[model samples]
Target: MTSTEQAVETFDSLDPTTDEVVGTYPVHGPDAVAAAVGRARGAAEWWASLGFAGRAERLRRWKGVIVRRMAELCDVVSAETGKPKGDAQLEVVLAVEHIEWAARNARKVLGPKRRPSGLLLANQAATVEYQPLGVVGVIGPWNYPVFTPLGSVAYALAAGNAVVFKPSEYTPGVGAWLVRAFEEVVPERPVLQLVTGFGATGAALVRSDVDKIAFTGSAATGKKIMAAAAERLTPVVIEAGGKDPLLVDADADLDAAVDAAVWGAFSNAGQTCVGVERVYVHTAVYDEFVAKLTERARQVRPGEHYGPMTMRSQLDVVRRHIADALARGGRALVGGADAVGERYVRPTVLVDVPEDSAAVREETFGPTITVTRVSDMDEAVEKANDSTYGLGSTVFSRRRGMELARRLRTGMTAINAPLSFAGVAALPFGGVGESGFGRIHGPEGLREFARPKAITRQRYRMPLVMTTFARTPKTDELVRRLVTVLHGRR
Candidate 1:
């Protein structure tokens, strides 16, 4: 699996539906990952030496490359992950937009800026600057291969750090396509490198001496990655799995809400980290909403609209969740146990499932969603906020959309839309609880890949200096008086 020469050999990426190899990519192991990181270390220095403007130019060029070759890359992504070409292209388009935003906004988000040192330190001039953290190791997931990873990759590049990307084994070709395209514009060095393999390879990347690691995957693997990175005290940004909820209020547009739930839950075979795994509909509109949702779910045929599960092992997990829900008296409104296919899981919509069932409590990561009836909007908000994972959520209502969206404890909430928060490049994306920490996309993404360096230079020596042994009892009394004058009212 390790590289022998500059030219690497090939490995197969299979199509889940046919169990056939659709594309071949280089299988890179620890040695190769380490080499790529080393190269990235050098490239990062060069990229960082170039000021913000210089980096922006190169990033824009990379963006152009992605835009121009969007179709070719989408074809590779489609073949590797078994996703429809349209879906692949959509993800790539979003990724390119993110890259462009990161490039244009990096200087404003991360450059040195003046900050007031508070009344106490008014004599001192304070400035804060975000410095690039040498190299970033990004371990991406198979679902939304382009968009998800670029949430980290684009920001890292724009912030002046080179990236070593280890995409999911199922989507290695997509990863290679991205890195190759990046090289076409920024060919001075390996600013972006691809390392492709299984879990062992991902573990190796986390253990490597990279400055920071951004991981998107299951929470179990996230814990392992965190433990590995802790050995070196390496900071990490993890966007783990989520059991996200889409709340439908009594006043919500039933038609629009149904459309969002179906598309959000079933799209991409329901393998999205922030996908709508749970739906809490207001009891006032429960029956109507469920009927609409069920009808819409039936309209989405797998393979044509979405792809088979890229990871074969996930099928069992999906089946077990369905079986657990069914055993607990949950009725499948659409597809049931038989929906779990050899490769693709048909859209399954279940109702009356116990809240504690695996399908509700765990991250299903499949084309299945649990529809529960909540008494009112308050109950819907409560139920939605109860999950341990709080990545992203959706709220649909006419009058109370924004208010209810703010009440949910998730990191990002979309009002009257599903996952729309992610599309608005200005909003930060990440999660609290077990869903993981640190942010990707928006200003937060730029800062996550950088370290804050606070600088304070004495403008002039103050008459009352506190740092030296030269401070007298009289000066200490005067300082106390000054502090009292400032804080006594508060």
Candidate 2:
């Protein structure tokens, strides 16, 4: 096929329900991605030369553009991903907040600071400062298209780096809208660039000469990105998949637990990386908790509550998870195989699913949750931390919420709430193990895009010289005597 025909024949973003093509985007290849990165390198210099104050002003102007044109951006998101306009608006608003915070706080968080050189280097005055990487390549997820990508993009820009963003194939138009808005604010250079395609395009971006890469996607894909980055020794920040859990204690507020579970499990059709996928309830209130969850689940009707699954291929995965749970002697009290609709999966709540089942262990990125009864808080913590993924988690308890939250080996935990850690812009957002590494959203986010530079200046020459072409036995003996005097067996 001709290049034009080949490009046209590539997959198009479709309306999930009607299966009609909603938009056509170029399936960017290696050449296109390389060219974009090349342009971004030049942009980085211009952006960095603006200094912190100038960049902050430009960022505020960009924020105004996004706030004023929120509806237009949401419309593009809705058309491309089939998510509700309200949900799209919510993501965009959070994204704008992040952009504003990054712009305002980057200098303070990343500016130079003094540090003690310790007695070993007593004659030196040590200092540390964060320097921006030249260019950053961000591969974002379709879910929360704006918020997730901007979590990286905004911080990178604030740190004085140019960004080349590759939004998910399912939400390329949303990515385009953001890039266009940013260009208007910094029209002197291509400070923000966009490339749209599938996995191949993403692979191209990872292998490019960008100084750093920020990826938000499945853990499986995160591994691939990390491995590819290793080729160029490129630093990366990965916000991968999560099988997050919400624990309930015997003395917990049943109403709060139920509310958190409902919203955490079913919101955005359960496509969130930090969404609750497992619930470990204290056996004392297991039955009561399950009943409350079921009632709340019923109240959340799929169509009015959320839109269709953005990726059509995810339908089979959702169906398989439910079927596997049932075949393994699990019961779906609220929704079963029949709940898997053509485009949207109705909220499914399963009980008695084996802990080893895919529905429990794997990331079933659908509107399905598995609830299990645990003997006590100990068992709850163990099961919650047993997963390969350790992103964010939630705990609902009156007396032991903080203790239990600390025990779980995840990055961040919300007490009496679901995914609240993400809403708090001051806290860091990331995970350990399979959930991925690196953080975003706060001071940690600002430093991720920067490299630490250590500076030391000699205040004066010490009597005991350590780094000159001259050495004396008396000086060595004095140094040993001083060490013994300070830290000897007292």
Which candidate should be chosen as best, given TM-score against the real structure? Answer: 2
Candidate 2 lDDT, 284-389, residue by residue in tens: 9999999999999988987678888888788898899999999999999998989988888899999999999999989988999999999999999999999999
> Which residue pairs show backbone clashes in model 1?
none
lDDT tens digits, residue span 442-466, model 1: 9998999999999998887788888
- Every candidate's lDDT: 0.90, 0.91
Clashes in candidate 1: how many?
0
Q: Where in model 2 is the C-alpha error above 4 Å?
A: 1-11
lDDT of 1 at 220: 86
Candidate 1 lDDT at 380 equals: 85
Error of 2 at 157 (Å): 0.6
